[model samples]
Target: GIYLPVGLEKAAYNDGRTPIWNAEGCTTADIVYDDLRTTNGWDSSYKIDFSDPCAQKYIDSQARMFADWGYDFLKLDGVGPGSFKSGDNYDNVADVAAWQKAIATAGRPIHLELSWSLDYGHVEDWKKYSNGWRIDTDVECYCNTLVGWENSVDDRWDDAPAWTDHAGPGGWNDLDSLNVGNGEMDGLTNAERQSYATLWAIAKSPLYTGDDLTRLDSYGLSLLTNREVIAINQSSAPPAEPVTASDPQQVWAAKNPDGTYTVALFNLADAPASVTADWSTLGFQGKASVRDVWNREKLGTYRDRITQALPAHGSRLFTVTSHGTDLEWTGYEAEAGTLSGNASTAGCSACSDGRKVGNLYGGGKLTLDNVVVHKAGTYQVKVSYISGDARSALVSANDGGATSHKFASTGDWGTVNVVHVPVKLKAGANTITIDSGSDGYAPDIDRIDVQK
Candidate 1:
């Protein structure tokens, strides 16, 4: 479990105090007294040095207290990365080792978790003594549009081999906690939240509840519980990699053990809307049963594919069980122009008039004209270009009869940029025009994938 500072514990003890920890104040009652030099005369620079009698006593005492409280896991924080001047070069490695020894000496079977980006190469040494440690910094409460927790995806946690055997039943890779259900979540619609949860489940990190559990709302509770959905996350098999995103609003499918699959349809748009996925591409031969995990409703069996309508910032989690023979190519495929390839770019500029935009890098852009719209619903157009580039691209889809939507590339190609447009279609004939913004550079044109 992740441990908050003693200051937070003190505030909780004192009927809660505002501004959390009073960083500037100095009192014996203040939780930071010893470390900040407000009450004790110990130098703040030597805060983490175990050789310091007061610091050692405080660390040892805290470990003992937590052990008594039945907390087998503890995350030691506030130990800054710099070296100690007064004590033996107080770095995280020494600090953690000291605490581990202290905890062992106290005769408690407590596990340790360290915070901040310490030298993970030393993880092998710490693992024998500690339980888990952070690969990044601490996560604050959800407030800003980009909550700190969302940044976890930017770094691949699975690439770290040291953490492999270290995680299981009682042990886990601490990827922080859920930022959803926190009323402060901004910039995310319900669909986006579902996507976030789905990603975490696939990552198989510890399911630490970061939201105020006592005040959980219905939607939040649904996300936390849905047994079938949660079961896939807890499964022992390696998770399926995400299908390529052709559009931000497209459905991403991951194969499950019993031949069924878990699908997450994300709404990259700010408003509530509905999107559709083609049945043929999903490998359904005829009709298949679909269950909506969130609503606990059966969407009935359908031949070929399933079409789901999602709310703004919300998504529909589905367990699609195939029936009868497998429809010729019934599983998801990356759409042509979207970030994930499972979308269709049939109506984009290049796909029109039988032209195709191919081979653009994941973060590149593409332009097509004379595209045809095969079906109609809500469609997400994504332009993936390289990461860290300051350049942006403008993409517009025109149906020739005056219906058009303009979407901008979200600077980073790996980041899915989305534009939602409502299209009305006849059974056989419709046209679309796509233009890459003339930003003095040719936008790398990946495939344009179209999802309903």
Candidate 2:
């Protein structure tokens, strides 16, 4: 629904032309219970065991194809919970690992969202492998209809902790596609939709539109394009915790990095509602300008309090910035240093350590030897590389710590191969290391630039 015209065809060639099919070749079948069988509630037909190397290989290939097609976000469905297989079952875990390997090898930045719920303990483990995973059964439509004296409902959106903690930057706990523009009776009202949007934005959930975008009306379009309100959700900083739901009609606030706060006001009553927050509760003691992100209007400056008239089931969002100020450049870098694959001169210069031999493949020990910074700020890091051998390399930032991001060069590197990491800096004292694990042919490191 995000307008991904790029489908499976182009993904097979790594052509950057369309959305890669995230779920490829994985089998699926309806669940059937057999009472005559000795086995309890288990059914053999619904099993999907991916630990088998053959199955893993197939999944890996599909993931590679998606990466090649420029599809970086994946939702691996039909592989967990109700979809479990019999003995030797490593379906979810193995598939995730395989996809991670595939994405790394392809040199692409991918966000994987897994279907079905995982064990609570596996949260950190999954985060280490993929960007995000779903923690519940598919989210159904929000509205429900009644038949006779009984209500027949098919969709619901309930929050659970099992998948919540796993959410943040580079990773998220998906709650499924948003039902914003859907006019179905089970669909939420305008205010309710606003609440849902505000919550998802604050949660940093993947912004997938469940409604048919082509048929969106003016109101739906306005909700989707409210840049001010949307910016809070798109803030670079990880999402903040929601203030406690003390009152059903009230929403709370949290502080962000740039002296700004993300504010949400909810309306739970049956009709229209209004609420206000004092500056003291938001941790601000001085005057601040309030900008309504939804309507994109300047609400003037307030020294102590702010008020809003939220329609029933509706809410408002604001990015309260200190009044009277210019845009501040957080950080900047001039040279990302030289990159090379030769281990002997790895410490000398960037290119001396690696070389670009071909568009699809390179032969050498890949290394980002030196990086110089001209300004200080938080920087997002990216590196490109290529390797044919099944070798994994360690990407270390500021020298080796217990943990560092790892990359594997797939057979091709001409595609948009990359990995991302955020680094904080002072004037200019940062170094990155690329240690190629004992592969016969060294990997290749291309350009390295810091994004402000």
Candidate 3:
């Protein structure tokens, strides 16, 4: 996600630290069903008691007042299925539903956005209520030079394609903000800034200027006024999908209303380099015409593939006719899996490329296909997971055998950890399946990595 400067009035929640309702009629008082309360009860966040009727009144009244004040966007952050829980994540569906009721009935149309990286497993829920939400952390954290400028950008791009089909007209993915306009505070070079803006626009993420408009430089101004770039981003079509997710370079493309494909080729590495997008990988049979969207230059058609050299932290945006195939990753969503129970997802920030699976139930089953490898050998298979408590499941790699492994707890959902299992992969493609194997608690899985 990009960066955006946002102003919010959170002080009104000063009174929310106390108990949500009186303990008079509550039998679970000592049970501590309060979602926001910590062991010391010092959490400053104003979490509502969504189970209480009065809480509904408070939410509705606040929403109505905001609407009356002519506010059109309300971002409900820090509210998730699992808010401050011992598990990978907790659910706060009811909490968001309450606020939605208040806002939708407020006699005005308001855009509802959630924040702090909601999980992609709740796509249906998010689409049903909020207009947009964040999938990655804020970009301004890169302001510290110690962190390096490119690290932040890389983190956002790594997971950009996980939700390709999740955005559209009524709502969009929030890539965060346009931090590039702030000059030095942006901590990015001109090329990086333009790339950042291009990535956000191409992803169909909501655009918010995070820098001070008064002090914006010519470079930032030029980027904002780039009509061709804005046109691609604002297009009604769905966001682009990743053609190359992991690499020295990443490529994403989408079909436009005019049937031309808008492609973004990114140099995600430190050194300047050129790369190629094979025609087969891009889903095209023949050659095509290409136009560079950013530089407004028309590059003649080519056969086989499109090759462009980009400087470190730079990119090339092209609108091409006969855009080739759009290849999807062998991710959890694309695999064959049996998901029992609610078939919901829990997510974490450290997951590889924001990958998530739908099976969290004990009896659930997941089958992954097309796991490519170079040679047949034993590899250390690492599964990314986050859980409030220890969890385990039966996992078999390449149909060799099943072994139960416990996924350790990470203290919080945002903090992620991995467990290693030994698996043998044959040359070329492989498939692995997982089933409930222990204590019946299947940890939320983000992705799997096998290393020699």
Q: Judged by TM-score relative to the true structure, which candidate is superior, 1 or 3?
A: 3
lDDT of 1 by residue, 1-452 (tens): 44643122332323213222222332223323343331111122223333434444555666677777777777665433411112223334555666787788666687676554434444455565566555444444334543532444323222322233344443445555665664344234455557667656654555666666777666777778877667767886444332323334555565666887666565545566766654434544567788876667888887766665666545566777878474221112124333322212332332223333433233333434334445554333333322222222334444434322323332333333222333334334333333323222323343344432
Compared to the true structure, candidate 2 yields what TM-score? 0.54
Q: Which one wins on TM-score?
A: 3
Write one digit per residue (lDDT tens) for candidate 3, span 1-452: 21111111234333344332333332222222344342111133334445556666655666777778788888766545422332222455655677678787887877888765666667578777778877666666644532235556666665555555668877777877767775566777777887888888889988878677898888888888889998888878778755542355766777788788888888867889886665544445468888888889999988767888889988888888874444333334312344455345544446665545645675676667777777897644556665555556777877588776645444445545544455678989888766664337666666665432
- lDDT score for residue 39 of model 3: 18
- For every model shown, the clashing-pair count is 61, 21, 20
lDDT of each: 0.46, 0.50, 0.63
Sort by TM-score, top down from the best: 3, 2, 1
Residue runs of model 1 more than 4 Å from their true location after superposition: 1-65, 78-176, 179-205, 210-225, 237-241, 277-288, 302-304, 323-452
How much is 371 displaced in model 2, in angstroms?
A: 53
The model with the greater lDDT, 1 or 3, is 3
Which predicted model would earn the best lDDT?
3
TM per model? Answer: 0.48, 0.54, 0.64
Candidate 2: tens digits of C-alpha lDDT, residues 406-443: 33333233322333343554457666555543443434
Candidate 3 residues lying further than 4 Å off, grouped into runs, are 1-42, 82-90, 142-148, 323-452
